[model samples]
Target chain A: MALSAFILIEVAGDHTKSAFKTIQRISGVKAVYTVSGSYDLIVQVETENLQTLSDLLLSKIRAVDGVTKTNTCLVLNV
Target chain B: MALSAFILIEVAGDHTKSAFKTIQRISGVKAVYTVSGSYDLIVQVETENLQTLSDLLLSKIRAVDGVTKTNTCLVLNV
Candidate 1:
């Protein structure tokens, strides 16, 4: 089963555009949106399992320059 | 452009299943997931504009039995 999650991202000021560009390049990221809220970006990502999902979140997505925090909500019943 | 959003919902105890059934019946809701986290469900909804989206969230989605709180993230750049 494919695991899909929405990552609510908060980035440092002045890094929004650059962070958006970098996040889109990450593997399995289906969509990235710059939004108006407490969070700056909402990212839709998919991976084969929970392990890969965590890897993407911790290593790839959070590693982007502007991203300060990521709140991940994994889809349980789709 | 069609406006889309993800609503992170927290519900009352033991109301998950009933709420899930009730939510999917709502007009604009595209997908509903039972998730494990601070929030219990993740709902994907689409409307013609922000006004309609807000109406759906406030009037329809939050009105469901179990749903106690909703945090909406509107898609700005998709």
Candidate 2:
């Protein structure tokens, strides 16, 4: 089954535009949008399973420059 | 321009399944999913502008039965 999450991102500097460009290219990221709120970006990501989701967050998302903190909310099937 | 948001919903009872069904049918709602976390559901909605988005949240989403609280994160353009 596919696993999806909304990864709320906080960027360190005034690099929202450049950061968004780089983030949109990540493999598992479906979409990324800058938002007018506490969070700088709203990222939609989907992976095959939880493990892949975890990897995507750690290896890809976190590694990106300008990203400071992340709050991941996993989508559950009910 | 299209305005989109991720509305985090909290349900009052064991009505997640029913809530999801009702929420999905609302106009402007792109998707609704039961999610694992503080929020019971992740509702994706898109409207023509911020006013329409506000109307959707008040007249449509908040009106749904079993939904207690909502935290809306407006999607911003970068």
**Largest DockQ belongs to which candidate?**
2
* Candidate 1 clashing pairs, residues 3+ apart or interchain: none
DockQ of each: 0.58, 0.66
Instruction: List runs of model 1 lying over 4 Å from the truth.
Output: none
Cα miss at A47, model 2 (Å)?
1.6
Q: Rate the local accuracy (lDDT) of all candidates.
A: 0.87, 0.87
Candidate 2 residue B30 C-alpha distance from true site, Å: 1.3
Docking class of 2: medium
Error of 1 at B27 (Å): 1.0
Candidate 2, B1-78: lDDT as tens digits: 888888888899898889999999999999887877667888889999888988999998999999999888887755
Shift in Å, residue A4, candidate 1: 1.9
